[model samples]
Target: MEDITIHEFDFALINEFFTELERQGPGSPEETIRALGFIGNLSNKTKIADLGCGTGFQTMVLAQNTEAAITALDLCAGSIDKLNATAGKLGLQNRVKGIVGSMDNLPFQNEEFDLIWSEGAIASIGFEKGLNHWKRFLKKDGYIAVTYESWYTDERPAEIEKWWLDAVPEIGTIAHNISIMQKAGYIPVAAFTLPESCWIDNYFVPQKARQEEFLKQHAGNKTVEDMIAFMRHEADLYSKYKQYYGYVFYIGKKM
Candidate 1:
C-alpha cells in the first residue's frame, strides 16, 4: 500500500474530486444571470475579478453570460493551468483565465474591478473578513456575490448539528450573513438558497462517479474508502436534512 499523506491529494484526489464539472459548488448559470441583473447597467468593457475561482467553472459561465473582461484568481497553480486550458479551448483566452493567487492576501490594486465575485470560496477567509477585505478591490457601487453556507433553522437534528459543528463551527445564519455584509461596507442586494439540484446534479453526481472509479482502481486501500466517506456522508446528510441548512448565494454592492 502506498503511504499517502492528507495534503498529498492536492494534485491527485483533489483533481479527481472536481474534474470536467461546470460548477465546483452550489450555483448555476441562471443564478449568475440573476445576480448580474441586480448589478444593473454594465457594458462589455466592465472589469471583473473572480476570487478563489477553483478551476474557473463559474468563471467560464461568466464569460459566456457577460462580456466583462474577467480575471479568475485561484491559489492552486494546477487549477489555474486547467482554467487557462479550458478558456483557451472555449476561445475565451482573452476574456477568462485563472490568475494564480490566494484570497487571504489579494495581490491587486484598490478598486481594480467593477465586479468582484466568489462562489463557495469566501469561507476560507471568514465571511465577514472576506467581505471587508475584498471590498477594497471593488469600484464604488460595484457588485459582489458570494455563496456562503448557512443554517436555515436554529433547531436542527443532533447528528447533523454535530456534523456541521465538526466542519465549520461558526457558520452563520442567513440573517447574520446579511448583517455582516452590511457592516462590512456593502449594500445587500439579495439573498437566496441554492436548490437541491445544485448539490445533487452538478457536484455530488460527478464526485460520486469519480469516487466510485477511484475505489474500483484502489480496491485494497482503506484510505481511499475513508476519504470518499466524507463526500458520501455529506450527500447522505443533505438528503435527510436539506431544509435545515444550505449554500445561500448573497449579492451586494460596495458602499
Candidate 2:
C-alpha cells in the first residue's frame, strides 16, 4: 500500500471533504472574535480581504462584528459557493463577497485593503512568504491576522514533530514565527495559542458525523478510506501530544 499523507493527495478529494464541514480547520467563533479585538481602526469604510476562507465561517464572524467591505477568497469553488449562499441567507450579501482564487496569486491590486485576514489556511503558502506576498495588498498600517500551526515548546517527541515536518515543513516555534513576521516587515501585534476546545469541540467532534456521511458517500473507495484513517490518526496524535504544538493566532500590522 502506498503511504498515505493528507497533503500528498491532489486537492480534489481534500477540498470535497472539507466543503461539507462548517470549518476547514481547528478554530471557533470565540477565538475569531478574540483575535478581532486586538485589531484597531475599523469603520464602515474599511476594506478587508479574507484569503483561504473555507466556507467563510470566520468571515461571517468578521462581517457581523465590523461593517467592513469583505472579499472572501478561496481556491475551492465548492467552498466559495457555500460561503456566498450563506452570506446571502444571512442578509450580508452587500458586504461579503466570495471569490474563487488562489491565495498566493491574489486577484487584488497593490495596497488596496485595510486588512487581510486568513484563518487556519496560511500554511498553504509558507508563513513568511504569505506575509510578505500579502503585504502588498494592505494599505499602510493595515493589519494581517492568521491562525497557523506552531510549536509551543523548544523540544517535542520525534514522532509528532516528524509527522508535522512532513506535512508542513515550514512549521516553527512561536518566537521563531514572530521573528519571521518582523523580517517580513510587519510589527507583531499579539500571538496566542488557541484553547483545546477549539480543536476537540469545534473541529473534531463536528467532523465525526461528517466522516460517517463521507464514507457512506464514497463507499468502498480505498483512497477515501486511507484519507479518513489519516485524519483519525491526526486527531489521535493531537490528543496524545497537544502540549507540544498546535495552532496559534498571529496578528501583525503593516510597517
Candidate 3:
C-alpha cells in the first residue's frame, strides 16, 4: 500500500473506473439539449466533433436530438468501444461514430465540422487553447459548445478556491472565460451554469452502486481505495462550495 496522489494513479485504472459509469463527469441530457438550443441550422449534412466524449453519454443525447453526423473522440479505448456498442444498440450507429484519440491532436481536416462539442473534458487541454485549436476544425459560423469548471462569483472561500486552483490552475470566473473565448476568435453566444442536480443527482448519485461493486472487486487494493477516496473528497468539496463554482456551459460561434 503506497500513498499516492490521484494523478499518480495509472491512466488505465482511472479509465476503467469511469467506464462503468454513464458519465465521467457532472452533466445531464437536459443540460446537453439546453446547450444545443443556442446553436441553429443543424441538419443531416452537418458534421459534429465531440471531443473527450467519455463513453458517449452526451454524444448519444446529441445524436437523439439532431440528424448531424457526430465523431465522438476520446483517449480511452474501452470508453470508445463501449460508446460504439451503445450507439449500435440505440440504432444511432449510423450517425454517432466513436474514435479513440487525444483532443489536442484531432484527426480531422480544417474547417470540417459544423459543431464542436465537449462536455467536462476541456481541462485536459487548457480551455483557451482548446477553443483556439479546435477553431480550425469548425466551418465559418460553426458553433463550439463545451462545459468547463468556472467560478460563479468574483470571490470564493479560500479552501475551495485553493483546492480547485491546485487541480485546474487555468480555472477562472465565467466572465474571464467568456473574454478568453472572445479573444480566441469567437463570438460568445450563451453561457449558463449547470444546476446542482446535474452534479448531485445525475453524476454522483449514479456512482454509488458502481463504486461499491468496484471496491468489492478490488478488495484490499490500496490504489483502488485511494482513488475512490479522492473522488469522495471531490464530491464533498462540490457539496460544500457548490454555490461558489460549478460547471458552466459556454457556447460560441467561430468568427
Candidate 4:
C-alpha cells in the first residue's frame, strides 16, 4: 500500500479539528460580529466576499447583521458543504453563496465586491500575498477586514519567533501587518488585537479534550496515530510561541 499523506486524513477528523476550535467563547462567531461592528456600520446591503470563510460562521454573522450580499469561499469542500447547509437552515441561502476555491487565485472579476472579510485563514497563505491578491476584488473605496495572528509587544522572544517562522513561515511579524495593508493600496481604518485568553479558552483546551476522547475511541488506528502526531507537532509550536500573542483585526479602505 502507498503511504497515506496528512491531507488524506478523514473528513470527520478535519471537521473535529475546526468544530472544536469554534466551541471556545470570545473567539466565537458572536465575537467576530461585535468586532467588525466596531469598525463601521454594515447596513448598506453591500456586496461582500468572505475569503477563507471556514464553515461560514463569520459569513453567517455578516449575512444576518448586514444587508450585504455575501459570497463565502473556502478551500475545503466539506467545509463549503457545511456552510451551505447552515446558510439554508438559517434562511440565508438567498443572501449568501458558498464556493470552494483558493484565496491565492480568486475566481471573481475585478471590483466585484464592496467589502472583503477574512479570519484566521490568511496565515495559511502568505499574508502579504493574500492581501495583495484579494485587493483587486474590491471596488474603489471598498473595505477589507482581516484577522491575523500577531504579537502584542514590539519585543518578541527568539523561540516564539522561531516557532512562528517554522510553523507559518509565510506571515511576517505582527508589526508588519499595517504596513502590508498600506503598501497594498489600502488605507488602514482601524486595528486592534484580540485577547490571548480567546485562544486558550476557545481553541487549545477544547481541541485537546476532543483529541483525548478520539484516542480513547480509536485505540491503535494508524490514522488516529497520524492525527495525534500532527496535532502534537502543532501544539508544541503553539506552546513555544505562547506569549502575549493574538489576532490583529485590520480594517482598511481601498485607495
Candidate number with greatest TM-score: 2
- Write down the lDDT of every candidate, Cα atoms only: 0.81, 0.93, 0.92, 0.76
Clashing pairs in 1: none
**Model 1 segments more than 4 A misplaced:** 1-12, 217-219
> Which regions of candidate 3 deviate over 4 angstroms?
1-6
Candidate 2 lDDT, tens digit per residue, 168-197?
889999999999999999999999999999
Displacement of the residue 250 alpha carbon in candidate 1, Å: 0.6
Two-way TM-score contest, 1 vs 4, winner: 1
TM-score, prediction 1? 0.91
lDDT of 1 by residue, 1-255 (tens): 123223334456555556545566777777777777777667888988999898888888889888889998887777788899999999999888688888989888999899999998887677888898899999899889888889999788888887776666568789988998999998999998888888888778877667888789779877677777766877888899999998998999888
- Clashing residue pairs in candidate 4 are 24-202
Question: Mind sharing the TM-score for model 2?
Answer: 0.98
Enumerate clash totals for all models, in the order shown.
0, 0, 0, 1
lDDT for model 4, on a 0 to 1 scale?
A: 0.76
Top-down lDDT ranking: 2, 3, 1, 4
